[model samples]
Target: MIRLDTIKDIIVFLLAYIPPLLVFAKFWREKHKNIIVLIIITLIYLGGSIFTQNLLPFILIIFDIKFIKSAGTSYLDNKIDNTYNKTKFGRDINSVLKFDYNRFKFNGRNFSIFSALKLSAISYTVSLLISIVETILLSRLNVKLEGQEVVSWMSSMQLWRFIIIIPVMIIFAPVVEEFVFRWLFFEKIFKNRMGIYLSALISSLIFGFAHFNLRSFPILVWIGIFNCYLIDKKGYWYSVFNHFTFNFITTMALLIDKI
Candidate 1:
């Protein structure tokens, strides 16, 4: 029999995640026409999350590339130009903004792969260190990590299963998460009134809470902050690249352990 607490947890999760998406729809896009695309993507995310082990559905995200490119990339140029400087939307990138190789002409560049990897390394290392510290502290207190089950399941996946999830982990997941947390939540929803530091903090906390993992909450928040910093100083694609690279490294580590 299903327990009442389990049902309650499900209700709570739906309330937190579902309502936010509705509110997010209003604040997420510059144009109202794009809300349909946003709603579809969120539905895809929900379905994909429910079957995370069977990750092939995530490849469908590639089909959604039109959403990002059509919405975002028409205006970006190597030169910052008057428009790039004037608009917050131009400066910020959403999820799945392709890092076209032809970009980065002369002194002015759209996104820097090398710089992204460097910062992603820093963010990834910091997350690992924080997790290690948290684990030690929690162990002393005899508290079991609520998040460990998910990590353990991921790490223990069979080779074929792990291989199937690679694209989802590196590309689709990063794109979607960055779009939601960084672009929609941090920039559009909160950053206008909250300023950089506080907005980043609140959004990062929300990002962490969305994962429903108490032990890794701080790590997720720190990663969120790092992504916000990238979007602030670097560009939207920078944070997307950092997030993908971070996930790549983590997914590879898990793959190696499974092997």
Candidate 2:
């Protein structure tokens, strides 16, 4: 029998995402409109969320597969065939967003400690700036919410939770999250102004909701939107950097207080 923890997320992921992903992939190959596909994916995510299961991860895997296929196609067409690459949505984001396999190859940029630090710095700075701006805006709206408390408390450097947390924040979180939210979803979904706004909005909302912190949901939402903008404005690198840095710094801050 599967462990409760293992089976829970695994089953949820498969049931919530596999059908829609297959449908979307087949539809994409046919060069059809992806509205229905997106809708199906969205419902799967919503269902997964409501059920509090691992469905999101499963859906993400499907999306990841699609992204990999697109990337391979893009690389081959650009390098070998000279045909313009197409996104899963049948739109080309490559004219502006270039993915250098040499630079961003799996064993290349991302695996390097230097690159990770650089990414952490950029992502943290951007996230901090966006958080500041958002704080100001929400203040003007006369709404207040909880600040980082338990995280701060548990993060005390005296406790050593931070030492463990920092690496998790930096290395573990960035790779998967960036690949899914920024690289895969943003690359596939956001094509134009409307799509851009929607992508940021939807993706951000999902990002926040995923946290499961009801009190901080709004803030997370705003952060998600800002992160999406950063991804569009700068590149996936910026988002990856900001995300790692933000998490690392916050965890450190908490750790320091504990110390």
Local accuracy by lDDT, each model: 0.64, 0.55
lDDT of 1 by residue, 39-152 (tens): 787787666545562242324323333334443454344225444433354443332232421221111265667777788889888988998998899889998867644466
Clashes of 2: 10
- What value of lDDT does candidate 1 attain over all alpha carbons? 0.64
- Each prediction's TM-score against the native? 0.64, 0.50
lDDT of 2 by residue, 123-219 (tens): 5566567678778987898888665444644543456545654665565455556555655455444535447778778767666644545556665
Clashing pairs in 1: 93-236
